[model samples]
Target: MDDLPIIELPEPYRIDEAQLTDQAALPQLMEQRMDAALQQIEQKASLRTDRHIQIMRENMHKYVEDRFQEAIRGSDDNALALVRGELKIRRADHHDSIARSEARVVELVRGILNQYDSATRVRQE
Candidate 1:
């Protein structure tokens, strides 16, 4: 062949047993990592939000109403004390920063809702 261009062959790929073993362990490793990640996500999601504050306030109010009713009915003091204790513990465990942030979010959302409500009212008018 006259004036032919020369081409070099590429090297062949190789696989090792250690690499294969590592590859086999990958799924289990990934699962453990994913579980940790999910736990972290759950913890973060469990942080108080505006809705949580609203719910807590509503629940506290309901508890007070129920306790009032119970008092009127002359219900067991021990049961009332237990409930009060549980509520106290929950309140003590409450994150003030989260609550404050939630309050701010509530105010912002309320303002937005009010704006939308006013706009709709005006449109209807």
Candidate 2:
């Protein structure tokens, strides 16, 4: 065994080169990859044990309901209507903020993937 010839393994391929050639395409590719990854993760995640998602949903609903109730307290008929309208606007704003936060999270995941690709390419070379 000590006299055996050492075989050189082939170098790993870099996916980053294709990515770098068309930087604009990177975001689209990353989005598709991230979407697939998230789907895979969702499929594998233990839904039965996912207490945080349920808790967060319940908390948000309770918070909104509490706010609406507070606004209507000691209010006349017209004031109640005004408060209800205000609650709707606040809910819409909250939804928009959630959307923005989700978008940011997606971007951050893509950034991490990009960094991983760069590091992998460097290591391969």
Candidate 3:
């Protein structure tokens, strides 16, 4: 209550002394004031509640988006690892194929050279 600002009443305000002494009407007047205060409080409470709900919804959306991005990153990493493994296997297979081809070529060349030497010797004899 100390934090509340003091409001100054406007000029031209006159109090009717008879209204203040009317004991019979005091209860009704008090009830009307209480009802108005309650209505104002309810309006403020409703506004605050709506604001809190909006904030919660926004937070939930952000959290879900963050989780989804994390999942995508995990999936991407797994896929990259799998591709690298497959590439390594294919490279090893290619190297083995090249080695086998080279061996076959060497064997064929040796056979051709031997046949040529035997033919030359027969001609000389």
On lDDT, the candidate that comes out on top is 3
Compose the digit string of candidate 2's lDDT tens values, residues 37-88: 9988887686744777898899999999998887677467678788899999
lDDT of 3 at 36: 100
Q: Which ranges in model 1 have alpha carbons more than 4 Å from their true place?
A: 1-12, 49-55, 58-125
Q: Give candidate 2's total backbone clashes.
A: 0
Question: In candidate 1, what residue range of length 10 has the lowest lDDT sum?
Answer: 7-16
C-alpha displacement of 81 in model 2, angstroms? 0.9
What C-alpha lDDT do the candidate models reach, one value each? 0.87, 0.87, 0.92
Overall local distance difference test of candidate 2: 0.87
Q: Which stretches of candidate 2 lie over 4 Å from their true place?
A: 1-75
lDDT for residue 118 in candidate 3, whole number 0-100: 93
Alpha-carbon shift of residue 96 in model 1 (angstroms): 64
Q: What is the lDDT of residue 11 in candidate 1?
A: 42
Better of 1 and 2 by TM-score: 2
Alpha-carbon RMSD, each predicted model: 37.1, 48.7, 13.5
lDDT of 1 by residue, 1-125 (tens): 87889765564445678889999999999999999999988877777565698899999999999989888767667778889999888886687757888999999999999999999999999
TM-score of each: 0.33, 0.39, 0.70
Ranking by lDDT: 3, 2, 1
